[model samples]
Target: MSKSAIFTGLVIFIIIALFPFWINFGKTAPVPEPELVGKAKTAKKCVLDKMDMRANHMSLLDEWRDSVVRDANRIYTNTDGKEFAMSLSTGENSCLGCHEDKSKFCDKCHNYASVDPYCWECHTEPKEIK
Candidate 1:
């Protein structure tokens, strides 16, 4: 009697908890695959490794910003001991240098993630040549 009642309550609780997952199981948006163009394709490198950049690029850029502005240090040495200019939208080793096409590379992932990064509030967005 009570055992059956408890079992039914447990089943009900689980169904309620997983209702959203069941409804949206196969309806998720596919992950964005940002395409590289220009220097990025040839260089095949970045200030950090690919996975690290994909996960924590914002944090890395923040550190670079603080270092350059506060300490006047404008160099970034990656794990491979390659040095880069700690810049956002300038220099050949900076973000925009390799990622020239903001629409193809940056916008795809940023939009897919629904992110409106404030980096463009001050930095000029690269002109889309096409």
Candidate 2:
């Protein structure tokens, strides 16, 4: 083929190959942040600060689990030296006491972040009658 025709064909090939990128350029919309639900909205406070809870909740839960099961320590002391029962199932001073609705508080964020926590698999979740 002639030089001009070859050059034009190459340019067309490149444009066609990158057509999808051009079409999608700057079209990305940010993912909508999941909202906190149920009692979490009105709760007096959380076990950890908002930012700490959001970042390290899984690790905290794991520590709680090990403390209760392996170390046989049933009482948890917060930063303020307030003690609470460390039972995950009973929902007394643990996670469920304040955030009673797992579907709302826990599951919403977990699903949004694509994390599948196995805590609910073995532990029976407290049922909300309403």
lDDT of 1 by residue, 13-41 (tens): 99999999999887977887899999998
**Quick one: how many clashes does candidate 1 have?**
0
Query: Compared to the true structure, candidate 2 yields what TM-score?
Result: 0.66
lDDT of 2: 0.76
In candidate 1, where is summed lDDT lowest over 10 consecutive residues? 121-130
Residue 59 lDDT, candidate 1, scale 0-100? 98
Best by TM-score: 1
Flag clash pairs in model 2: none
